[model samples]
Target: MATIFTPGPALQSNSSEQNRFMEKLMAKILSFYDEQSLIDVTFKVSNPTAVVPAHRLILAAASPYFENLFRGEQGNNPVIEINDIDSDTLERLITFCYTGEAPITVNNVGAMLKAAIVLQLNDAINSCVDCIMKNINGYTLQAAYTLERETQCERLKQKLIEYEIKNFMEISRGVEFLSFDVEKLQRILESDNLNIPREEDAYDAIKRWFNYDVPARQEPLPHLIACLRLTQFDADFLLTHIQPLPGCELLAFKAISWIREPAARTKISMRFTEPRATCEETFLVICRSEMNYKLLQYNKAEDKWQEYASLEIDYTNYWPILKDENILFIGGYKNGVSCNIVRSLNIRNKTWQNLPAMNQARRGHRVVELDGKIYAIGGLEGNKVLSSVERYTPSDGWEFVSSLTVGRFDASAEILNGKLYVLGGRNINGALKLVECYNPDSNTWTSCADMTECRVSLHVRVHKGHIYVLEKYSANQSSQSVERYDPERNTWSKICCLNAEWARIENVFSFDNKLWSFGHPKHDDISSVSVYDEDNDRWVKKCSLPNVDRYTYNIVPVALLSSK
Candidate 1:
């Protein structure tokens, strides 16, 4: 037995009672909906087998679509044709007009929304948009995007972006993602809101779309590739995945130059370095030793360093350079010998390849990239210091550049303000505070203001247009202090002193505007790492390296890549 909460049925007062009375009234009115005794309008749906009969008053009172039709009618009975929407969708929409509610699923949300839009039923269209949002997923996201795109549904489009951004990586891995229209894909890529942790994922998505059917999709590659941050993708990724493609020739060359010159990033319209561009920023650490080199990637989510590979050569005293997913070991010592074997390791493929060796066998030298060319300067050769500078151009091999005034070894070098500046290193003078600036065009080294302190064992980097040097305090390196040089004034000032613990910091990288140092320092023996809170001017211990081995590891040469 069903409870009749409507009491006497004389127009209920409570909300629930009103709903019940309305439903019952709708059912009763719908019972006589097609009866000829009251029938005045007939609708012929586009589906051949469908025809619906309705009373003029019931429809005219509920919908302007039928109201306008009835007002313009000239005969006793008029047959109206609704060819825009098929019968099933129209039938449900007609019921919704009377009942003030409609039931819909993901499969029919598009059709129902379409009919409601054509009928000028704003309420029903809102209901359809809500329904679409509730059911949107990887399977239906693209369809909803396409449908709403055509319908111009702004509310639904916003819901689509929120739902789809989190699943971008998953969507790219799907076959449907590869099948999206080039324009549609580009629209999605244009968003700064995309949650692609790695710029590589964005690049990979485009590669998949182009290669899905190369012969047919080749034409759109140019337009689509324009959306990626190609310059940010380093050299190996562009070479392996994009550079080899004949269609990517010009784009690849421009991207390579872009990597070398980040300031002139006008060629590409987008960059992946923004705060919201990714979920987690990924970085790498190059663990170098006299015997071998190990590549480790630190995963923030996992809070651990996973080794990428162990190379076959002794990269000790090596000058490393990164081009995308690979690192170049340019003229480093192998087995205590100054070897000029220039090799590169593809971090993605874990494969090594050799490039043309330098004109002179060099180790403990400074290598820096400027204007798309490599310059190696100042290093020791079997206890003897050499200043023979050489320039390397891709495909052009190495050419002799003007040598440094004083022979330097173990010198730290970084390019800044369009000039290569080599900082503190051991010259014949020993642990000198010498600072010199090298001009590529002029091929000359100009002496600059020396540092406040000297360093034989030092960690040097250029950050925010300033050169920072960490100098050791003692033989055990238990105490240390840092000084930064302002290029504008060519002056060095002491910043802060670090607990001798940082003496072992082989490599350092800054993320989220915080400094991260990698390596175990001194008697701490346990591999220790720390993060420098710039605001406090102090180092906060972050974590310790895995204690899998008794051998203390030396980590250096850090690079920032996409987390994915």
Candidate 2:
């Protein structure tokens, strides 16, 4: 009994050794499958002359669909009738079962993916999905989108949608775009992400699709036309391009009504009043004094400036947001008293309309637009820093939502990835480096990684999936530094500094794929615009703006006004 085998320490399995064993085993099984040796099952495909013979044990080990089917078989060898899978797909799947690989191309990837999904072959399914996504292009987008929809692959479907939206200008010119069904075309036209320069281009695309086969496409023309922001078009386009369309008479008339009479927009559908993702934006400045508030628009193309509109009301430090063809001015001060008066300007007609008032009166507050609603964040009311927040919906009036974790004024806010981020500000204690994030879906606020330096009166802008914060420059610092926040890593990194000449930065915004800082230098009478040179990681002076006193200049957020 003492001579019985004594166990020693267990040996660790090496990955290389395991891989070699699997390779040899797979080679042997592949040979067996290729030679039709030890074949125990036959697949009868839809084609009369096509039949596949495979080893039962290998197929049973590969997929659970086959394992369950074989387990229920009443005989040693069975003939399976497959009406859904073709002969070529069946052979490829069987080869993958033995060799762990399949020759998947764009031509056959859709069919192979469908067959693999039906057979519950997870490895083959993933391989086919990868192949389909790899070869997706403007020419193949319709087919890929249809396949993803049919297979219920939600993630793949989203990728297809993004591809179509980003490449709509090219895809709409291709033959496959004409072949898309009405539902698919309608969905594409309804998206705000379409890379179109103007609403006229969208109408042109729809007309082209309709003219391809007028008789068959006429019925869906109106539906497709409704998807466009018809009101955004000018009168000349409405008469020459839209009115002449086969089935767009009603749409043309309604659009003209909204354009001529701004009040009609209240009755019009919000879909037609919304702006596309590519709306043209420009810098808007408001210089305020005792009773004078001047509104100016910057012309970047010509490096010129012009007066935009004259304001009748006197409000200081009010927040202005551009929504489609309108500009909304939220919570500010009137005669040194905090007020909740909200004003909306329809720039097309130069008309101002009164919106619902905020619940709390505050000045130096931050306002942002998300999901077609407006949010007014933390600010100072009287001598107390308030943490109250309010949201204004078009369908509903202003209502209070979740308050900030900390009450501070002069803070900067930006929307990134569907969430609102409020950065550094000043409170009773002093300047703050605290960062907080607000999620509208959960109606809650949570803290984020703090800035490297405590700051106030900073400006934040989101560009290309990153948030860039412009810290105000003072005499102590050589230049105003810019820090970028990476949401994926939840960290902040200093990218570069602004021109040392800029003694202070009043606002930071993105336009034409560049970050522009608006401010003036020390002892300078006129403000200036400096654009970030990303290639060199430094700010370059673009041009000087019209003279405005830095003490009286109200830094309005950049406005993305409708070009129409």
Candidate 3:
């Protein structure tokens, strides 16, 4: 009884110590369970007498600070348990939380994003997104885009937009020669608040970010002025005193207004250069309701213009070709004809002839001349989109070639450095911005850099080792937009747009060392002859085509004499 007098204080101290010990024990147990679950393993003593401490295991698992940091309210709920996630994923997630060193390939990024969202770990979520984006390719981009759309996570969406913009911006810079995916770009542009920044604004932004010296007061020089500034002057007159800059060309005073006329309707034809014995640069255009074609000739009697001749042939949904000095027109609706026929126009003899018919009648087909052979590319063969391609040699006639990865129509084809470059076209379902290059040596097509815009029925020409594409904005509409591609750099640059009335068709060619385009004018009263001077970088007007008018025009440039 006497010893018990002081027992109250002692008992109180013991009780406090026990409480603390129990608290520590619970924490250890929790950590141990967490660790065991994360790694999908169990720890047991080798001997029955040896007891493993639960607290130590728990502590190891809970040591990752990020787990607790991102736990938020979820951590406060004592009954809440972590879901079954892969051991590696859990470990990586924990590591990211602790040290902020994001795992390069954290599979199930969407799930991680969801977890980050729930945990309110903004940094972790952003890091995961960046990792996903860095690894995304064409195959993954669509999935990523879909995921972003489904999640509706504001941060994720922002990140995606940022990624797309940055990627395209970088692409735009390096794309001196590019084929754009118009639909993809349009989607991006539509989804984001992207605007066409003024040149000054772009320059300013570049200067600010790069900290490079930029001309403070860059002046807008006229095409003539710019031409005079170049150092090399050999064949300067080839550009007609117009400096053919990458993005800018000379503008003809009269041609400008003609292109600007709103009432120009959907078809107008113009003739460039009066037919002369010295420089017989003449064009005849006919714009029908459906399509148009041009007849162009280069007369060298004056030794001014090279002797070249061309005729534009129009067909309903297929690319027109010139074979045996005759226009082989494919893919168009002939009222009673069930199959598409190859309508030929003899340029040399000035007559029309029908040749061996296509096995599968198609529209919007691409015909390319490679190695003295003509290959008919993807288009609508009857009502079906076709990936099948066929080749025509003087000896073989029409024979099937390998099919493309995708079916395409309304596409443009050009030969560069002995390879076939097919740029911006559409499929049967929609418009396309895909760029494919076919190598005859390899007998295969490989994807290449894309363009900044999506356009069909664009005017494409190769000049001075560059590809120039003049694209209209819409079907049955006129556009002033132009783009140029440099195969050497594999990049595309925006060139000065043509006047609005200057429609796009297969009427573009390099004549007299200059770019000449003939198409259906947008304005009824305006002419269609568009001449681009590479030297002066300007456009000029010649006489309008006297005959043959149509909506869609085709031109075939024939060399009367070998320039070589």
Best candidate per lDDT, number? 2
Per-residue accuracy of model 3 over 13-54 as CA lDDT, tens digit each: 798786887789766644654564443322232222222212
The lowest-lDDT stretch of 10 consecutive residues in candidate 3 is 227-236
Q: Where does candidate 3 stray beyond 4 Å?
A: 1-319, 336-338, 350-353, 473-479, 499-506, 520-526, 533-537, 546-564
User: In model 2, how large is the Cα lDDT of residue 494?
Assistant: 87
Once model 1 is optimally superposed onto the true structure by TM-score, how far is the C-alpha of residue 100 displaced, in angstroms? 46
TM-score of each: 0.51, 0.51, 0.43
Model 3 RMSD vs true structure: 24.2
Model 1: per-residue Cα lDDT over 469-555, one tens digit each: 875334445466778989889899988566636535656665644677766666676667788875677778865765333222322
Candidate 1, residue 32: CA error in Å?
53
Angstrom error of the Cα, residue 461, model 1: value is 2.4
Candidate 3 similarity to native, TM-score: 0.43
Task: Report how far residue 315 has shifted in candidate 2, in Å.
Answer: 2.2
> lDDT (CA) for every model shown?
0.71, 0.77, 0.52
Off-target runs (Cα >4 Å) in candidate 1 are 1-281, 288-293, 472-478, 534-538, 546-564
